[model samples]
Target: MRNSPLHGLRVVEIGTMLAAPFATHILSQLGAEVIKVEPPAGDPTRSLVRGGPSGTFIAYSHGKKSACIDLSTPGGRAALHKLLAQSHALVHNLAPKAARKLGVGREECAALNPELVYCHIRGYAAGPQQDDLASNPVAEAATGVMEGNRINGRPSRLGPSYHDQFAGAYAVIGMLAALLQAKTGAADRHVEVGLYETGLHVAARDLVGVQLKTQLLGRAEREPHGEFAMPGYGAYLTADERWLYLLMLTDGHWLKFCQALDLPQAADPGLARLKDRKKAREQVEELVGRAIGALPFDAAVARLKAAGVGCTEVLPLERVLEAPQAQSPGKLREVAFRGLQFQVPEFPRHPDADDAPATLPPAALGQHTREVLEQAGLSAAECAALLDSGAVRAVDPAGFAWAPVRATS
Candidate 1:
């Protein structure tokens, strides 16, 4: 832990669902001590669909201490205040109304601890649509990801929840930048990250192409048909029934690719330039596809490598996971939870590391109520009283539902 970059810093995570929790999970991987505050019922994802802790919850909450507190109660709110007073950062994805209702709104937290970095992750940034609620799929549509990554002119959602993952990554980046600013004598700041904005950023190259081509080139990029306009810039299936993608971004690569694949027409002066090849795109694709498709996957990849053309097999996720590099300490990690061992993807080890340390086990809901509160300077008796009063809770497989609490006289 001492070798990790964020070793001494502490973070308090207050949220439901994936985005904000994932962001803090990344921070935890970097050695920040993260205390996850959940409603007494636990995050909805914990029991999504068929019930029991879901894989998504385990994946995102690994290495965090869970504290179950009903923020609607005075005792619960007081517990949060105590936790915030000693924490360096707070992360949440609640809507404006929900945030204020819980008293962890940006202004509210700022008043509690001005030096704290308050990171907010939301479906959208500030705008007329700021209040418009969206889930991962909605964000995918809103940011054009579903519409842009298409097959046969029909929009399709990608296999993974990319928008949520991107939003989480952006939140981590924003918080890091804020921490850097604070290191230079600037006050701690509020960092905002939105799923829609992250989607746009992730699809930057496509968006930039639209701007440049329509404004400058006087043409729109052709609707994609599971391939690029450039013959060598997309995937092709081999004779052995395996798929591989090829890339030849420069003239030099094009020449080498043609020679290596034994395509005679590439030498014709009529197909000398990129514009000329694009003009005969169908013909070029036919020639290139036939040349590569005639070979087995490995043979095709070998020839492309020898010719210095970039090529890779279009493998499924499980196959890719079996790659040697993916099994390295920095990429894949083993974690134990409830007597079961699970292999999880890990962030690259921080630059300050000398060895790969074991990752923290994922916490069960409200598993750390007493320990975390004790760290926040609560006596054992006070924590017990809070639990007895229905303000704080310990892990209960039966689960607890959150109800609005009436203030005591």
Candidate 2:
């Protein structure tokens, strides 16, 4: 019953994929009344994978309502405009050309509601390469992330959905700033965020470093890209095939690590010194790897921890879900829906000690269609008519899948 940070704010979401929806998802978690406007076939993310809800969709769309509308239709567009007129903000990720065709572009929406903050998410900003197609991997490749991730001759992409998540965070920050500006009586503002731009921003340090050296940081670069810069900060495979990632940056921790591994000569040989260890990176890695390989995973981790070195077992997805850290007090919560238990991360606490409400499981497609329409002032008859006219549809308990229209020759 307590007021949340975003209490009383209303957001209209017209995004199908990750970035824009993710921004609105934060607003929703902070108590905004977010109404997600899905196409007749629904957001592509809803059907991106088989079985259960699209994990990405479920994660981003928790605590929001949904409505299926065929925006290309005149009646649907009118309904969307009405929704926009009542909303405080609009967030979308439609392609530039598609947004123009649907009449939901920033200029058009601002014309309808001068106070509405409109946020647009794109694959790239306006420039010579503005029109280029950029999915997450493509953006990563373009921004040098994928290339920099290669080490020891093994080139690999970053872990799941990094670009989408990063861009989403940036878009949310922009929208939040616009909201503050609106409260200050500033006119409605249009904000744009691009995945490629966010990716480049994330790699700013590496890019700048390479520029300074007059050489591009390519996949062929042998230098480590991440915390690997620290001589003792990296992953080591244990005798039991499990990995133990440890960080021993300070001199005290390095000494403790050598003592923990019972390698007295490790310190005497000057491997404990930062500069010397970095200079002999390969030799240090080999010695550490050999020591780790000699011990069972759990025992090695216990030894390192007992010696005051910060170390943890590298957890896989399933293990992460059941991690002790995740189950600790005030960490994660489990919500049940339709005989399924869903675990979601709790919101970050506000400095003033206020917190958002407990999360609701993601809606089952347009699960609250009738309720949402009624709340929006549509009569029951009108709601039925809209459904019958193919302008809207309710979530089917049986579920549905996306089938994008294909061009025929």
Candidate 3:
């Protein structure tokens, strides 16, 4: 973390929920000093996750400072303005009108600090439905992700905030690029990311293929390729009902697959070409399926891999954490926060890094209010007045600094 690219930089974040917060979380990991500005009532998520310090809140918010400022009040707005002037970047996930009201909109932030990289995250990009409110589920539904993820003819929303996470990543990318450009010349400091648009980008290939092929070429939509779209490329069940997926991309691969599985019937010259094998896809797939079904899962996986075949076990989602792949050395490390310890995965492999990068504990509401206002150069008297006037939320001494749960409990 001390050697990260964004080291020594400070970012001011104002928003609720996922998109905006997630962006700053990434920035924080990249070594930026992120100060999250929240309402006096605190981020809605503080009470959201089983009455929070919920897993979601702690995961995204740890390793940052919190200043519970009430944007509705004069003092709180003043505090944010001061912070913006002293920070390198400002981020918010509010609608345009809401941002304007809170004085954190693009124009407002740019006016405060022309060099500031201001990032605005929202539901949609410039569109007929630009002002429409959206969240993770809404973005998925609007971009056909839910429909694309259909099961038994029912469109299902993803379990995670996949689109929101992508939007957050995009925001970070835009902000970093803007900062880089600023170093060279006059640059557009305002960066924007929209959730619905991000969802479309994630499915760029499908969007282009599905729309262009059908609309311009007058071709029907292709049959759903269950896994890999080819006969030799899909999932098969083993004798113990464990699933494994295979990928045979070429005629050579088909030959290899045949030899690996020891299938004398499939070694004929008539089935050498992928096109020919695809024509007999049912027969080809069935042959491989029976061969695999004759052995236990561990044996089948080992045998296929030893033959240089591309394959992997279809581990159930619930058992993913138990998989050896996810537990490899340096993949995850134990971090304590919100009275619980979790094995969080690390990102950005750095050659110089000898240990997993360190992250601070999640801050309680206004945990750093007094500390940050002072750092922003506000006098003690001024901070006291704001706290007294309800411009800032009170803090809990015990919860402000997170501690791990005791083992005895």
Candidate 4:
């Protein structure tokens, strides 16, 4: 196997849902041994969709180990402390107050492992609104993303869980930086990433533009802005009712686009300049709409490609998976769990190489309790006792298939 950038590093993740786990997912990809510590009931995301628990769980937790402990129990806290003491880092998304109640707060964990790079992902930073509990939608709503999405009039949520995922990415970057600092002799660092803050940053360009009132030359909106009124820059519905997104950024591409649609007048006299193009947006849009509506989806796509116009069918999720771009070597990976097959997208190539594995199936709740406890230097008897006493529990009493080293005889 190729060497991973995070090889030999150990991370214990106590975060449920997205933010912290997503950050650790990046670390796990980079070859870090990330042990996800979950409650006996497991991370709620494990049962997110209607499907049985396994699929959803496996999707988020691929390439990681699981350990289930009842943090409410003293024995459970002892076992967790043991794991924390031996870990290089801990990433958690628990609320500060909740974490303090659970005894895994930064102060508590850092005292156990001073060298640990501890990252706390929160929904909001300490502020007037610090006490507000925010989920993805709340964060989006607070950050103006929801408003941006509804710019056309009707308010709606963005398709994906952007706030959670972006916060996770931010947390990952912070974790890596903190790890580097620790290597260079810095003390353990406590990094906090707020999902609301991430949402705010994700809307940075728009926010900045609105704040600064910086519009594009001769236009009322900002540059790189989407053109709802322009014919070439927005989605066009085909005869089959599928949408096609056309992007003709340059004059050359615009000419080709006009040629492809057999509407040479689209780039003619009155439409020659960009200002004129904007002025005639409604007419241009109607013309383009009629042209696209006249052609079958594939035929239109072929015509655009042949004419050197950048185009792509607005694909459904299933179609996207089957697209040639998705099937390229090293682009996607197939993973199986209990005879169930699923696919996960591979990481983009980095100058150093892909940091993490292509796929890490999610874990069963408390699947690695016995194994993890044993790795933390608990004796078999002690592990069994803890389980029997309800200090820890494994979803599968048989424990996970992975090995947890036993202490030397």
Candidate 5:
């Protein structure tokens, strides 16, 4: 982190669940000092999976410090105000009303520190619809994306909590842009992002089609048994029953794909045009499938790559942990808890230390409460009082190093 870009910067995160936490986690990885303000009982996500230190919490909060501050109390608010006065950025994903009540609203915090990059993330954008409660699934259902992903005649959520993650990512973008603006002079410290609006942007292309009254083509309308928009451009089974995905959208891709698999159609000028190939979908898929099905998955991928055709074997999400591409150095970073370690892909890997070992693990609830409060300028007596009153909470400093998990059974 000494050589990292945001090494000396401080970011205060008042967040729970995914969106706000994820944004700060990325900043933590980028070398920002991220202090996650948790509630007295700790973030709910801490128990969302296997009880303590759940996977959801681990994935979203690596390398972050947790400080429990009860914003509902005057003592807590005073302490947070002191901390924000010296911070570079503050981010939260609470409801608009809840934020105002907590005194962490953009305006409130910005008044304390004008140059602070303040990010407010919520369910919906401003206006009459702003307060409607929404999380990932509700936002997706409100927008057209969920309907577009209908399966078996029922609208279904796409596997991941993509909307939450996307909102968090956009919030980071907004904050980084706002931070840059500060270097030029008086900066607009306020940045806002809404999950509902993020969903709108995710479905923007389809929205454009509707307004133009033009045909909107997408995988949702794919043919029965086809996983993508066109023949031979989807997941297929090989001789070993392993799934392989192919991407051949253009005329050149089609030509290369045919030659790669040694299909006789390579010599047919009549099938050169994409439109003609579409017209002959049934038989074309049959020939393509037969050729690919004759070879094992590895051989099929090799032949396709040799011809400059795009292809890959399809593995389930869990199998990605050991996938060669994912296992390669600089592709992932480690997160640990109770002496157990796991890895997650790191986006925009650290510049000077791509292969560096993980330096910090996710903190326990209120893990750094005492240390952070002291740094925030709270007197030891004040800190002790707040901790006693339950306005703040702190785990023993020794708890920083997680002990090995022991068998309970």
Candidate 6:
């Protein structure tokens, strides 16, 4: 957008995997120019078995320029230093020591640019396990997120990458706070976000639920029944075997539900109130299930809603893609890469740029290395030497040109 909040900001993202890259991609979506520095192997995500671009990679890597630089080499480190010197921010998710070893640690980066907003993401907090590599399920498991998500009495991890994305979003919030400080003429600052901590934060509600069940409900000896324990707050199967979720948490909703079903048992004094209904949970659930199961899916959903109970048919992933809500403007953005077109959710939105957000394709590996180096004032021969020495890699840049004048470093 012409007046995007992050316009003219420059970020150097020395990130691997999902978290850090996703944070930087958020910045890019908000109109920052994010230069994603990858190792020679190209972030390891490029090798996924996907038919085209890896979904995980594309989701987090979109709208950023990629520069392949082998940080193990002196030339590569020097180039990164130059970029950081000109960048407004630097973000990475490398292990603590690995970041320091590459000379991109918080202190090193601050020394390069005193006003830079630096963000570091790691697997855990600053403890003995701080330096261990962390990915999605690892942090999810370590933080007891999996344990809290019980399915049929067995602990299960979420299939989606929750910890990684949560950490990334947390890092983005930190970056934005630091950027605000810098804009006010503050010195460079560092923000650290850990996947383990994010996992804990994400599962905080469940943790609270567990405590309430044990302490308040006095169910310490019994594993508290889940949402389905509430008569009106559960799923029901229709005649066609499709499921619909019903949420009747309040007395008003419960009364409406009972009135809609016209259940003679609901009029009983013992079952009129929610507290009493809890005592007859099985009977209520059975009644609700039978009432719902006698109808088709649509009829079941309509009945529940007509009764003032919030309800929706459980949608599979494929059905969700076809839903009208998914087709709403600004919900998804169309983007193209290498002549292939697809849609991704438009996110990291701004109040001002709601209608004019950029939908640029992700950069090809090393697609902007030469362009960035040239903008950094490197001679063509110097750029050639770096590429030839295997210190850096780049595409021809064919028609791409980027400016280095608004250096963030």
Instruction: State the lDDT at 322 in candidate 3.
Output: 82
Task: At residue 64, give the lDDT of candidate 6.
Answer: 87
For model 6 the TM-score comes to 0.88
Model 5: worst 10 consecutive residues (lDDT sum): 217-226
Please give, for residues 87-107, the per-residue lDDT of candidate 2 as tens digits. Answer: 888888888888889989888
For TM-score, the strongest prediction is: 5
lDDT of each: 0.82, 0.79, 0.81, 0.79, 0.82, 0.79
| lDDT of residue 77 for candidate 6 | 92
How big is the positional error of residue 105 in model 3, measured in Å on the Cα after superposition?
A: 0.9
Predicted candidate 5 versus true structure: per-residue lDDT over 1-409, tens digit per residue: 5776688889999988889998888788778999999877678887655446567688778778888889899988988998899889998989888988989887788789988898988998796888877899988998876776878989888868999999999999998888788888856888889999999998787677565553444323323431554677877899999999899788899899988888888889878887888788887888888888899998999999999999887878788778887887777777667767788667666445643325578787888988998897888998999999888888754533434458898
**Local accuracy of candidate 4 as per-residue lDDT tens digits, 174-220:** 98889888778888588888888888888897787765654544444
- Model 1 per-residue lDDT tens digits across residues 268-346: 8777778788888888778878887799998888887988888888888668878777776567778786656777887
TM-score of each: 0.89, 0.88, 0.89, 0.88, 0.90, 0.88
Cα lDDT of model 3 by residue, 177-260, tens digit:
998899899668988888989998997877787777799779857446435557768788999998888877887777777777
Off by over 4 Å in 3: 215-217, 351-357, 397-409
Clashing pairs in 2: none
For candidate 5, give the lDDT. 0.82
How does residue 365 of candidate 4 score in lDDT?
70
| Model 6 misplaced regions, further than 4 Å | 50-52, 150-154, 208-229, 265-269, 348-355, 396-409
